[model samples]
Target chain A: MTTITKLPDPVAGGSKHPQRGKTPRPGRGRRLGDLRIALLFILPAMVGFVAFFLIPTIRGIYLSFTEYSVLGDPTWIGTKNYTAIFADELFWNAMAVTLQYVGLNIGFQTVIALGLALLMHRVAKSTLIRGALLLPFLVANVIVALLWFWMLDYQIGIVNEIINWFGLPRIAFFGSEQWAIPTIAGVNVWRHMGYTALLIFAGLQSIPSHVYEVASLDGASQTRTFWSITMPLLRPVLVLVLVVTVIGSFQVFDTVAVTTGGGPINASRVIQMYIYQKAFGESDFGYASALSVILFVILALVAFIQMKFLKGNESDLD
Target chain B: MKKTLGAVAAAAAIALSLSACGGSAPASSEAKGEINYWLWDANQLPAYQQCADDFTKANPDIKVKITQRGWDDYWTTLTNGFVAGTAPDVFTNHLSKYPEYAAKKQLLSLDDAVAKDGIKLDSYTKGLPELWVGQDGKRYGLPKDWDTVGLFYNKAMTDSAGLTAGQMANLDWNPKDGGSYELAIAHLTVDKNGKRGDEAGFDKNNVAVYGLGLAGGGSGQGQTEWSFLTATTGWTATDKNPWGTKFNYDDPRFQESIAWWAGLIDKGYMPKLETTVGASLADNFGAGKAAINTTGDWLIGQYQSYKGVETAFAPTPKGPEGKRASMFNGLADSIWAGTKNPAASVKWVEYLGSTACQDVVASKAVVFPAITTSADKAAEAFKAKGTDVSAFTTHVKDSTTFLFPIADKAAKVDGIMKPAMDAVLAGKKPASSLTEANSQVNALFK
Candidate 1:
């Protein structure tokens, strides 16, 4: 093993005096080797960031402050686009819808995904059950939305047929304002919960068998052991899943666009759909970029708050 | 293992950056040698492809490539292509889209091309050639096809209701009482208990079959829904066509017409807005659930499935203007300004607008050709198909059709009015809800 080394404090102004004790340092070659390996490993990610994310994000910010329709030279018009976005009623409505969508989606996805994961953990022939459950997530969002759209058709849908069999009035799953968002949330949960469950299942598997054995030896009941052990250890994974789910939920566009087309009086028009209309429908790229920037900020703030509120320290694992 | 992973990472970084740089520039070639043509409507694709084949056969030196994209994707892709300087040499253009494209100078002016080729502008449908002219008096495209709205009704329902042929043919309407038109529709609507809308004990809440359906959200252009009624009241979308800068959505005549139309929902004459969620009016009509549908002529074939449902067409009801009217809209072929093959591109556009190609287009009976002679041929062809297209053709022969509104801010106007109209149609709000939307539309011009 390489020995740890210490160097003289550079902040103290290195002195040649004998009273200034010699401090040991790590081997220079080894440190350089480590740095070189790290850079090599990180370079691909850095390139992808700069090319796809960083460059586009920077350009988008610049475009937001200009009057651009993507056909002509961008005219500088500082803050005009942002001001318009703030004053637009549709923007606020979209924001409200998006937040509602995110809350509902995360709520459904978390509870159902965790439950499924726990069930899978305790079941036999889990591989087959897990594979069958993940089938929905494997399908594309557009396909899922379309399939659900047909399945929920008021006149000819299987779902409505079932409702009719129950002697209940047929529900307009996609047309009614009250049901559109919830229907979208249900479809989103159906398409994503399986993936989330698989992730949580992986986290569950990482817990050592000894913990459960020790808890059993202590005469702890099944529920008590789960609350004391599984819940505590699963905190990090839950936080990660929550953050990811939040980000995904905010950027949802395809589901709403395909199923509702943001209709029934814009009841389900989320922020991304609003941005898309501005960008493509109105051909107002500058305003769309401004909206996109605002959305990015919203997502970042949400993720930051989630991290601060839910993340436990490393010592929590012990 | 670490070394291998590091090498792989470095290679990936280099490859990604190189790929990014590689795709920034599209390979552009001499345009005249090989021209790209694009269209959106899949139904019209095969006809245009035949035209392309014939054109290529005549001009051995030049080649043509045709691309078909769906409606929404087409516009988005074409706009992106214009920005990227890789737009096709010639493409199909809509009346709503060309104004903005022309204003931006992304479209090539065809004035010189028309004069050089001695193309007769008047040979096309009335008012169509003028529709392609930009606000600057420059022609940017040539009319390819035209369409008009008409009444599509289920014959079985009307027969059962004992509606006379004359009543259906000469139905007149007014914003005040809906005239004979409302009477016919009310006679046709039935409740779950088999009670007609005009009958006693008819439950409006439990309507089994609606008399009519105004499909699609009644956006600013209620083309087939309320335009005919509003037009008879002397209402127009804007002050002028081709380059109207203002929208007239706040006109009381228009508002009253919309109110009357939406009121049909409450009166149980029309389907509730929620009923048209995933299914189209054509589908509903074909399924024998709706008695009547006032939609574009293009949907006639779609509705005439011959599956125990007998379908027939009738001219749009005469409005208080003392004449029948429909919204006359057409599509055209336009050349990109950046096309290197201007000569060939204009040639293709002129050919598309010519009687020769249009006659071939008519034989397909997919759309009414822009040229009058070709349009007549289309009617004859439709007759051969055992379909009566005179409902749409009559407007053209009588010259009672109004131009579909075109303006600099057409898309903006649509975004503003669609939601407002949705509210009105849903009965959550009255037609007066369009006042704010109208003001916003007018503000776009200012």
Candidate 2:
């Protein structure tokens, strides 16, 4: 297609403007043609974005200020739904749970992923081990949750069996209030660590081998070389992983829904589950939308703060 | 790149337009009447398909297409369908959701259709016909089948414990003392060292098998969990039957019953809440890991199919009210208000609720039919299959039964109660948690 457009220009230059020995302005038709071609290139994406994302988001914001149950016509209720959510104790409780879940998930996933990446990078010969480690990441969230639900069962689970073998009492992983949230975070980390580790591994590989060679020449210890070279170079990828993970942890629903249904006393009922209950479970779409907007603001604020913090102070690498 | 983009865009536009126009409209005879019917239960699919075949044979012009979804997805998708204007011409409805749908005018009122078709509503079980009536006194659906909770015990285990049928059948219960039913559960619960739960030296932590299946921590309905016992204690879900605005979760009797139900965990007679998380109580019972299961009668066929398991059914134990009570709930076939073929759809619903079709369902014995005669036939068919379904039939015929709770904000009630109930069942708190939960439930109405 670019070839066709170029052909027209060459033809115009040779046949019509050759003797003038001057660079010609593109014809109005040719300029319009370029515009059409650009539009053609972008139209499909634009249509999808408008249809699925833009329209729904605008409508959701509109709904947050109105009273609607999906089945009936929405009534203009002003800011009533938003005010109600602010006053609702359950909403705040869900927010607190969601924050704790995000903290635990991000903290565990980052440490596990970076540690695994370091270990796997050292054993570079074992591609099969890397693939095997990634098997959990490939499994669907629901399947992972269901598998863990059984594995963590207090009586019949293999986990409890192993615990009993060591002359220790079995832990009620999902049933106990203190254990439920942390156990869920552990499961999320278990399922996601492989993917995050692989990302870090890619970043590690991108740090030129000569940099490590130079560090070895300097007689820097392994830990010292890592701190001076690898860590600084891995900053951007780390930020990317951290942001993606924080966003995802806030939206955790499938694992919680399947494993606990946010139970043993709402210990695992994160914000997404609460919003889901309000929207689909109770048919309170307006209130749900209000809660959703609040979540959106929270996530945006968190992401901004993270980006600011990550970019600030010109760390030794910068 | 430009031409490729144009081609891709054109294809996407075509696809979008095609999807916008997709999905066949509701069946009308003029456009080849092929009505879609939806239901949730996979076990009932074969029986319903057989009925659809029979309906098609009788009415050659209309074709019935049946689709099955799981229980949770069925309601979610159906509600979404109602919003999308793509709901099936006819679909199965539940008592819990029908009222809300009817209130929203999503269901086609079948009152005039029933009168015009001369359908006898009396043919269904006694309370079922009235159950389909909405708050406005309009009939929104036709009764299809009913179910009740019962005590399912492993016959071999009960017999080995020297528990006779008479003792099991005559057991009565109270909140203070657990009656003979508790004793039976204790006797059946054996530790890894061959001591019963009732024995002094029994190791509660090392019990090999629970005497009762408490799989899946707790249910909001209390259907199989504690509803039977609680109902027998004269506890009702709401102030009224069909559309009660107030719930009674904070009632003293109800709280006591839940406390006792949760106490079984301490006694080592029931599975811990954590152990129940992803386990199916029915599967546990079928595998002989649970000595008894208090659940709905719909699982009878599933248990009967287990090779080495010998199952027996008994009524829920009588309570302080001097009567055994169970939640009597039923399914109905409703017409979508958006349906184009109301006449044909009504015809299909009437047939589904008729004896001819119900008899097919009864013969399958997967579920008890709504029609009293069909229910009796189902019992005889089960007897022929070497299983008795009278445990459920008796609830309909003789036992004192309460209607399943229905309310405007039923889902809100659940959102409030389920976690609170889970707390009690998990032993984190007593049933007193319902005090705050009840306030939340009532707040929804306000």
What is the C-alpha RMSD, rounded to one decimal, of candidate 1? 6.0
Give Cα distance to truth, residue A194, candidate 1, Å.
Answer: 1.5
Residues B1-446, candidate 2: write the lDDT tens digits.
Answer: 12222322443443343344232222333523888999999999999999999999999988999999999789888876766566898999998888888877677788777877789888888999999889988898899999998899999988988998878887788899788888888999989998998899999878876888885534457877888999887778888888888888889998898898899998889988866666678888877788989989888888777888888998888888678888998999998877767667878988999999999999998988999899889889889988877677777778477898878877777777877887788788878888888888888788
lDDT, candidate 1, residue A167? 89
- At residue B386, candidate 2 shows an lDDT of 81
What's model 2's lDDT at B431?
A: 80
Output the number of the DockQ-best candidate.
1
> Best-fitting candidate, measured by TM-score?
1
Instruction: Mark the regions of model 2 whose C-alpha exceeds 4 Å error after superposition.
Output: A1-45, A120-122, A125-133, A154-156, A164-167, A208-218, A312-318, B1-32, B216-220
lDDT by residue (tens digit), candidate 1, B1-446: 12222222443443343344331112233325888999988888888888888888887767889999998789888876765556898999999899998887778788766876799988988899999988988888899989998888899899999986667889999999999999999989999999999999999988888898758666888887788778988899999876887888899998998889899999999987886889777777877888988988877777776598988889999998679989999999998876667677777888889887998899988899999899999999999999988889999889989999888877888888888999989988888978878999899989
* Clashes by residue pair, model 2: none
* lDDT, residue B174, candidate 2: 89
Task: Provide the TM-score for each candidate, comma-separated.
Answer: 0.90, 0.88
**Cα lDDT of model 1 by residue, A7-96, tens digit:** 223422354443543432323444566668778989999998776677778778887898866655568999999998899999999999
Candidate 2 overall lDDT versus native: 0.82
Q: Can you tell me the CAPRI class of model 2?
A: acceptable
Q: What lDDT does each candidate get?
A: 0.84, 0.82
